[model samples]
Target chain A: MTDKTPHDWLNEHGDYLYRFALARLRDTHLAEDAVQETLLAAIKSPSFEGKSAPRTWLTGILKHKIIDIIRKQGVEQPAEDMSQYAAEEDPADEFFNERGHWADRPLAWPAAENALEQKQFLSVLQRCIERLPPKLARLFLLREVHEEDNESICKELQISPTNAWVMLYRARMGLRQCLELHWLGK
Target chain B: MLSCKQASELLSQSLDRPLTRRERWALRLHLWICAACRRFGRQLMLIRLAVGKVVAETEQNENLRLSPEARLRMTRALESGQ
Candidate 1:
């Protein structure tokens, strides 16, 4: 490959690699570092076999770089307790009576098919997710974004299966409520 | 009888883990009569689908790019073998 190949990689794959790292690491600085390390490693390697797509190969390297960071970080801080999120306190109460019937039924949302196509919907969704408490947000993403299984999520966050379940429930409830108030209002 | 609260928790838990036969039966029975819980269940599914789409869009969007400083630093490191 020519000298321009590295520059080409930088131009083409930089943002993609950065986002992959960010999603795994969730720290902008660490994500940037991992991207740099992956590109540097790719450049230093003896040959490019072109066996897999270049982006895939780069991502594979980036994944390892992220794993190293996770390992070095060792035990993550315990996920925030579910009680800290206000939504957990009485989420059911708002919608259900003491007898557990619907006291205040959820409003009918606009057709989700139409809503998904709106570009603003995602921004609203993202902001709602950001509003979640830090640990809840992480757990939500671990399941939804990373598609990690429950066991891995518990192991990574140092929480029990029960805690994981409660937190996830809270996160989902919180997001749905936030969307209703902020985004889905007609 | 499973109230809406209990039934809703069952629905959310079903997404994370399988429901027990008893829990499934209870939730089913409650949902049968409660139009509100039924609507909530459908909304939950929509939230799951929409979240998946937003995450895909997030991965592809240009908004998450590295800063110029980081990009330049990475480029220089690659070029110089440092």
Candidate 2:
């Protein structure tokens, strides 16, 4: 019980710690609040033993805070609809593509990594991404994009392994067609 | 005589790579003559490529952030707690 715990280390590393939380939570007030809670919990439990980088320790706390923020936001911005992103509230079908393929023809582009460097590239991708269903976008973000494995994505997205596969398939299909149309201009 | 769903399921596999030799022959034969399936295959390929690009783009941006403020806030919280 001789450990300094989270609160004891705070005065020495306050600004540094807040920076970590702010990066994830994206709000000044919330970041402050999350740190406050993490400190209170660490002091009460006395489990914040001295070991790894204190910054890392705080970051772990902030990560939980970030997750809380995301969950409280009620829903991750459903990846499907760009319109919804603007309005921030919209009811839409999970899989609304009636067609057998992507709505937009794929746009030819420089390699994706190359395309990302340019701001204009995202614009061409807008419609095609909009075509993806919410779950599909989330899956795409988690899987191919994030390099997350099937198990982790399924757990976070609350989807079955089978559904995860389908969403990925759908995501790929949607993006491919959209890119082709843009790139080929057909 | 695969149903629409069955054919669709196989479509994903085909894009990754053609199905088994026997299945490929059947599918290839079907795609050769069937305009609808051919278009469908084309659509799927296009979609696949587009997603591949977008996914790459998303990852590159994933860890990036506007700045590092959380750590400072966490430190403040700790100070307050004491």
Candidate 3:
């Protein structure tokens, strides 16, 4: 690795690391702190011989930093009233009729296996996630992205098993509606 | 007869935890007859896949750069570590 100064690392990889951190951490200040920690770690490590892309190396460090924070913090109590997101109650009723049948069937999506590779689709998905209420969004990510099980999520969030299930279900339902509108509708 | 709502909840739950025999049977029956619920289940899986991809690709993305102020703060922190 070239003897690049800290400024060089910042200029080259700071923002990318920040976005990566922010996407998972979901807190602006914490994201900044994680990026700061990543940069500091990079400086200490002597073996970053440019074997991989600079951004890739920095991201690897940032992933660890984010995990460290999540571990140290344990379960973060939702910073706000989670009930507001939950208070609306599940709109499960709308999907069914009096006899508990599909009042409105879910619209069919094109069988595009490559949709996941499309940048636009991801961008739309990102927007949909961002639009979710914070606690719900975090729970969704923890479950789907982090692969945390229901018990751990319930334990960490200090919610009951039922609450955890409801929140996750709502998040999926919400994401489905959002994608139907933004990505598929496009 | 599980409502689409019930089936949807069960479907989402199955991703997190193992479904019971009753749930599995109920969901299978519901999906077999309800095309809309079936579509929802498929779309839910697609969304999960897409999110995983987005999260993975974000790590290596270069299009987004840090702001000047933040870059400076992060840089100083690293230099101070040295």
Candidate 4:
């Protein structure tokens, strides 16, 4: 099999690469730059041995670029003030009663597997993720999207392990409510 | 008996870390009696599965893309680098 030229790579995989980066970086310029950088590196390296699909190979490179940028941002940006997060009201209070029982008990989501296959459901999920508080969203993405472990995430966000767990719990709780309200309940 | 709030929090934390024997037993006991908490646990798992699916299939999503100008700029950069 012959190798495709750089233009061919761009034409075929450009948007996919851009979307992947944007999901992680959430900054348009950074996402675009990451896609470009990945393509350039792919062009320079002779590492494509045709074991995986072109898109998969490109994504591998893009993942590293994203991680590097996140690391840099961790250093450049001030540490997150986690005290404010700690002081924030428990999200569970909205769903639980004074007795700590579920006020609005969770209903079983019918056909949840089918919802995953639908494009509309996916978009709703994306919007819910975007609605998450910025720090919570970052922690969620680092764990769910980037597949980073809790230790590294704590280090990257300058949050303690306990705080990371609390933040992640908040993020999941928020996302669950948003999904139920917007998609499942409808 | 674990309250619904504590049980649910333990359920969420189980996704990130292993629960101790006592915590696991308490959660199990609560889930056995609490239908709502059981549903909550399943829904949390579904949310995680949905997020993974979104990441896996992002390439097929037409709503998200690089703008034309950015694409053009990247193309130029690639050409120059070549």
On DockQ, the leading prediction is: 4
Candidate 2 chain B: 10-residue stretch with minimal lDDT: B58-67
| Per-model TM-score of chain B | 0.82, 0.62, 0.77, 0.75
Per-candidate count of clashing residue pairs (backbone under 3 Å): 0, 45, 1, 0
- Please write out the lDDT profile of model 4 over residues A1-186, one tens digit for every residue: 546787888898898898888776767888898899998998888876564688889988988787666665652222244444336555567878979998887866766778778887788888898898654665677677666677776675565777667767778888888888898764
Candidate 3 chain A — worst ten consecutive residues by lDDT sum?
A76-85
Instruction: Sort the candidates on TM-score, descending order.
Output: 4, 1, 3, 2
How big is the positional error of residue B78 in model 1, measured in Å on the Cα after superposition? 6.3
Model 4: how far is B62 from its true place, Å? Answer: 4.9
- For B1-82, candidate 4 gives per-residue lDDT tens digits of 8999999899989988889999999999999999999999988888888887776666466898889999899889999998
lDDT of 1 by residue, A149-173 (tens): 7776566555677766776777887
DockQ of 4: 0.62
iRMSD computed for candidate 4: 2.9
Task: Please state how well chain A of candidate 4 matches the true chain A, as a TM-score.
Answer: 0.68
Output candidate 2 Cα RMSD.
8.7
> Which candidate comes out best when scored by lDDT?
4
The residue-level lDDT of candidate 1 at B68 comes to 95
Clashes of 3: 1
Q: What is the lDDT of residue A173 in candidate 2?
A: 52
| Tens digits of per-residue lDDT for model 2, A1-186 | 455545455654555555554433435566566666656665655546654676666656655554454445433333444454336332212222343332232233455456555555555665566566543453454354333455754565454665444545556555655555674465
TM-score of chain A of each: 0.66, 0.48, 0.61, 0.68
How high is the CA lDDT of each candidate model? 0.74, 0.51, 0.75, 0.79
